[model samples]
Target: MLLRLGSLLFALPALILLVLYGVEMSAVSDCTQLGGIYNFDTAECGTEAIPQTSYYLRHSGLVNGMMLLSVLGALAMSIGMLIKGMAQQAKS
Candidate 1:
């Protein structure tokens, strides 16, 4: 019961986060879309570029870190549950 409940808590949240991350990743915007210019030291693309960067690129490290941690946590819990089951089976 404990294993099932704990796995549900971890696995469900991890799955939800993974889906959300995928959705967020799909809606990505690139600087090139604004113009060929990355930044406007002078007139660029006939206007100031403002050197804008995508939200995902700016915070990708944090996002990836969170995703990695969640995945690892879910995997760890799942493996632990499996190991416990195997032990129980061996006992029987």
Candidate 2:
């Protein structure tokens, strides 16, 4: 029960984050398709390119780090649960 709860805790956040990330990516793609620059910090699409790099691109390390951590955390917890079940089966 504890393992299941732990897995849900990690998995839920990761799932929500992945959906949000996908939405952001889609917006960026739409902006690019329309020949506009999308500013992550400002959350604006503009015809004139900004001198500063994109908020998302500039802070890519941080963003990617978060996504990686959350996803990996969920995966690790799930794998642990699976292993525990397999071990129990093996014992029987």
Candidate 3:
């Protein structure tokens, strides 16, 4: 149970990142098809260059912190499972 949970936690961030990338790529494609520019840095769609910032970019710190926390939690859970398994093996 712990192992499964740990593995899920470990994969959660990568899954989220992939999903976000897909969404952004879709947006960029759609924007281009509609005769607009997709700004990578600001994540905006406009006819011309504009000074803008994306919500994700603005909250990058928070996002990174959450990912880091989840990874740490996954590591802890995996370690716990290992210890539990070791204890069980020693008892037999």
Candidate 4:
């Protein structure tokens, strides 16, 4: 149980980060649709304006990759705990 809990505790942050990356992707893909402010005034109203490329997205990809690695590590730790628990049970 403790192993499962620990795995979940570590996994939670990675999951959150993954979700955040999805949101950031969505925002960057559709900035104007999401009510982003436009600097230039155009004759045609409601025209979608492109958002400037931000370094945040690039850094976010790196963060997402790290989070994925963390998730894998958590899974490995959980499996190790299970094995340890079984060995202890068998010894007793």
Candidate 5:
């Protein structure tokens, strides 16, 4: 029982991050639809933009970081859960 809870605790953060990143991706896609570019300084979309490629580039970095963390959490949860199951089976 404790192991189950521990595994779930490790997994919960990954689920939360996945949802947050999904929303962020949606917002970026919406911004791209306006036929304008996003300004990292103003955090808004505009025409005749100043080529703020850094906005997307920095965000991509953040997304990549988040993805990496989430994957680690998932792997931890998988291993923890697997160990818990085996321990229980051994006891039975």
Candidate 6:
């Protein structure tokens, strides 16, 4: 019960963030307004374009990738915990 509850808590936040990231990516590509600095004349949030520096490009990708990984990891952990809890209960 405890594991399932904890997994749910973690999974919910991860799923929310993943959905947010997806929305941001889609908005960026669609060139649609995202309010604030993410509006026109910008690539996306936490991103900038530099003439000579590659950091801008790399940083954007890295940030997105990290978020994706976190979401995946959280999902995996949640599933693992739920399975383990079920297995333990079955043995008793």
TM-score quality measure for candidate 1:
0.42
TM-score of each: 0.42, 0.55, 0.67, 0.42, 0.49, 0.39
Per-residue alpha-carbon lDDT of model 2 for 1-92, expressed as tens digits?
54665566566665766777788789989999999998777777888776756546766776666667666667777778898899999999
lDDT of 3 at 1: 65
Higher-TM-score candidate of 5 and 6? 5
Which RMSD values do the candidates have, in order?
Answer: 6.9, 4.5, 3.3, 6.9, 4.4, 7.6
The best candidate in terms of TM-score: 3
TM-score of 3: 0.67
Q: How many clashes would you count in candidate 2?
A: 0
Clashing pairs in 6: none
Compared with the true structure, what per-residue lDDT tens digits does model 3 show for residues 1-92?
67767777777776777687689889999999999988877677888866656646866875687588678768978797888989999999
RMSD to the native, candidate 5?
A: 4.4
- Which pairs of residues collide in model 4? none
Ranking by lDDT: 3, 2, 5, 4, 1, 6
Report the CA-based lDDT of candidate 3 relative to the real structure: 0.78
Candidate 4 lDDT by residue in tens digits, 1-92: 55665576567766766786677556545755756543222312244664444435546676766667677767767787888889999999
Clashes of each: 0, 0, 0, 0, 0, 0
Runs with alpha carbons beyond 4 Å of true place in candidate 3? 39-44, 51-56
User: Which lDDT tens digits does candidate 6 get at residues 53-92?
Assistant: 2333535665566556666666667777778888999999
For residue 44, model 1's alpha carbon misses the true position, in angstroms, by 24
lDDT of 5 by residue, 1-92 (tens): 54455556556656766786576557667788977666656667677557545433656766566556656666776777788789899999
Worst 10 residues of 1 by lDDT: 38-47
Put down candidate 1 lDDT per residue, 16-91, tens digits, no spaces.
Answer: 6568656544433243465444442332343344655554566577666666666666776777788898999999
Cα-based lDDT for every prediction: 0.59, 0.74, 0.78, 0.62, 0.65, 0.57
Tell me which of candidates 2 and 6 scores higher on lDDT: 2
